[model samples]
Target: MKGAPRMPQDDADAPRFARRVGILVTGIVAVSFWIVTLLGALAVVTRFVRTIVVPRAKRTEPVRVRDVDLARGEIEFDADGDSRTPGRYSFWFDDDEGHARVGDITGGGAVTVTRRIIGVDFGDLRGVSRGRLGSWFHLAPGEFGHPYSDVTIETERGPAPAWLIPAAEPTDRWVVMVHGWGGRRPECLRAVETFHRAGYTCLIVSYRNDGEAPDSADGRYGLGDTEWRDVESALLFAGEHGAGGVVLAGWSMGGAISLQTVLRSGHAASVTGIVLDSPAVDWHDILAFQGTLNRLPEPITRTVVRTLGNGWGRTISGLATPIDFARLDVLGQADRLRVPIHILHSRDDGFVPHNGSARLAALRPDIVSYDEWGVARHARLWNYDSDRWDRSVSGWLTGLEG
Candidate 1:
């Protein structure tokens, strides 16, 4: 009694059951794969967001000082991309107790490059073994033959320190100089002489979380979304100090902040012009360029950008408020610009790509004067060629006066 005669139904049920089980197993594997992929993407997004919002710790010493020849007025440093770059730069050592300016590369070997010492502002370079290189070649306003007073701008976050360098002649025309991300007021000192000669009082300002300024509630960078507010306070300070007309000069992230202030500030009517050096006009473009430079996947970049703009990403980015990237897009809102803009961007800008500035200039050629340069790194246009930089700025300011 072999159970019963061979039943077609039973045979069919066996195959059907096997097929159903196979389908279930495949579904589980596919779900698991997607879940893993999603988790990985989330991790990438979180890290990218943190990088944008978090303030990096100040580097104690990034460049190794190989030697310093006082008689030759030259300094030797371990050769790297920044040290080898053709331009003048500053070095701070002993926790900024020592400062020195180094100029055009004189010579180099396999691992070290020697540069002419422009001057040692305060520190004796002889005993220094390591230091940090910077683009702020001029350490103070006095270096440019102008007396400066340390002032404070009362910002929403708190009082932020600023350098108020009066013009050689009594004048109501003023220029508020904003340094880039992770930059200090000293970086703006390089442009003080040019603006001062043009009879514009220079106010070099520090914004929130820039180390010198008070930290924000979250202590995170807004990528210009929130930093612009601090700059607005600087504009108000200028107006109170008898600024009949003002020009906003900014570098790198400072450029982005200046743009936002022009668009959002109540005192914008007082602003006559804007000067942007290696400006990050579009955050999206900047972030995308940065991602590419760091070899991040396109998907990760897109997700990180999305995270920065939405509510859900606030926790991940440590942002008190979700950034409205659309508002930060100067190119998209070019028509709203009321003041003339002079953009000095280098074709070889390694940090902020020049395409955004180029597009903006092309779109608004009538109001935007683009002075494209060659071989200048980001925010170091003046360091590369001070004469050219000064001439361009002076000429532009003259036109603004007219």
Candidate 2:
């Protein structure tokens, strides 16, 4: 049989068959790999976009108060479109800058419910009354007994609006306050009360991408990478405006900005101290902590973190340049810090983990005075217990000022 002349069709068919089989196997493997890689890449990109590029709506629209039952200490209201009242909340009228009322929603129904109100009202409601606990409660610099004047801080971008609340007794030492991510300048009003009372002038500032301030190129958060420059500009403004020494009081991401400014700014020597509340010291640590809470795989988060700082990832994430995650790592660079830093962190912080701050404190106990609180989430240590939070922060300021 081997000696017989082989037919042309038979010889051609054998080679052709082998070729087709090999191609099929190769195609299948390549396609499978491509699909898996695409999916993983998508996951990484989505997380990066959500954290860095996407703008989270700052504060929810206020719920309307339908009726107030003074006799029963309950107020009825219609919650329309994401106005669900969960846990304890504060209520204030349209004209009332004083958020002097706290209450809880006791009755839950379809659309309208009743809440138990504590404290007195702001006289009588006239116009549209809006109720919010976290945000609107903080007055815009001048309300609630603290006198404030509207001022502008000149930045590289443009003039950024701010609130300048001078202390009763003028001191060259000023408290330059920075708010958290998506937080307005008024968010510093809580800290303003404590610092103002302690005879320190407060300059609550607004940075880029704050909606009111000049928008960034992509309108994305720099995660303290670029935002720190705005903070440095504020320091320059303070120096020009008769500030001898400055105490930086920052919350959440603001704390990161403060740290970066101190490390990067030439005027760092003028910074007497820093106060960080639930600060995002290390972004990688915080992202991983949140990833654990969301039950995302470690590999995906690792990839996301890697890509966040990678140039290729920057292109994919719509960023002009790669994020400097190393710069955001205060814990890693704790030894470089020269000024005294006071950190107030909560063990139960959901957004930014307390471990990062704790590690920073442990790394430089001589420079850092860390105060840990329980049962409070990120940036709400003061809201949980106002008196205690104020006293502790005031005491730290006193030590630094003295």
Candidate 3:
């Protein structure tokens, strides 16, 4: 090796080779890092999708009942955001065996709050330790003084339970009410009396994957995609039962389902108007807002949305059919809406953002009557101010009649 006198070229080649190796090693490490990051993001997105599609079987009771003074018409609860929030709320205890209405925070401390108990609908509240607070103040239509009959609407999945409350004065107009995500027929009972007073028969329906309705094949929520079909069946039932004109009233995700029903159903011609409360106008918007609320990274939210929209993601999302987000976007297709829409959304909605509703109202003011509220939480506008809710809805119904 020493036979050749040290050449300049040979020394130059040594550094060049070292540089190539360095570049190659750095490239490999960067690629590996990206791969690991992608895998972690995918894992997070999978869990998020599961929660969105999977139906929850049990309701969580986070409000603890510290004491119940029935004689004094008062109830004390361990103070929390929901328990301390103003306005009336329903308390369900012992697997929903007991239900009571609590109104107005009478007194409050750092760790406890006592509310005036309006009345106990059922079950003894004496020894109840804990319960769930909700907006379902009325358990059934009868609670609001309307006689209702249990009827079944035959859907593609099976018979779905519904509450049929006929109008006191005979009228062919019907208002088919749909509840929000994970809600039952009782959630729609608050709006029944108003519709009944306006001479509209109220039909509160339960769609598939909701506890009251028959389960779909996948036992998952379609997030208004497939659930709309069940609502279509309800519309057909209403049409068969002499519904001359129909109004579709929905809350939260139910609004999404109602939007889809009107756009996709053959029976859409029968729908003369729509009423929405705290609606999920766009699933993409809702999911993005939720992702941000949960502190998820932006890329993770985008990837989750892409996965939900692609066929290859079915394995991860557990969806039988890849969701078509473009089709579910009501804002994108506002021009297609023919019926009058009355949207009542609260600025303080914690669950679903009201911006989409505001945008929709701005876009289609001709057909949309947006009644914006200041303090009502999601789907609880009636609970917050029943007089205003009734006036708005009744006025809207009167406009439709005129």
Global lDDT of each candidate: 0.89, 0.77, 0.90
The regions of model 2 sitting more than 4 angstroms off are 1-37, 40-44, 57-101, 104-115, 118-136
lDDT of 3 by residue, 1-402 (tens): 543333346776877667766787898899999999888888899999887888777777888989989889999999976776788889899888888898988997989999999998889999999998898998777667667799999999999999999999888999999999988888998898799889999999999999889998888888788999999999999999999999999999999999999988988999999999999997888899989989998888898889888999889988888888888989999999999999999988888999999999999999999999988888999988888999999999999999
TM-score of each: 0.88, 0.80, 0.88
Deviation in Å, model 3, residue 191 alpha carbon? 0.5
**How many backbone clashes can be found in candidate 1?**
0
Q: After TM-score superposition, what is the CA distance of residue 12 in candidate 2 from its true location, in Å?
A: 16
Give the range of the ten consecutive residues with the poorest summed lDDT in model 1.
1-10
- Model 3: runs farther than 4 Å from truth? 1-40, 109-111, 127-129
Model 1: runs farther than 4 Å from truth? 1-40, 60-66, 94-97, 109-111, 122-130
Deviation of model 2 at 331, angstroms: 1.5
Better of 2 and 3 by TM-score: 3
What is the C-alpha lDDT profile of model 1 across 332-379, one tens digit per residue? 999999899999999889889999999999999999999999888889
Displacement of residue 365 (Cα, Å) in model 3 is 0.5
Q: Choose the strongest candidate by lDDT.
A: 3
lDDT, residue 147, model 3: 73
Which lDDT value does model 3 have at 284? 82
Return the lDDT, model 3, position 105.
89
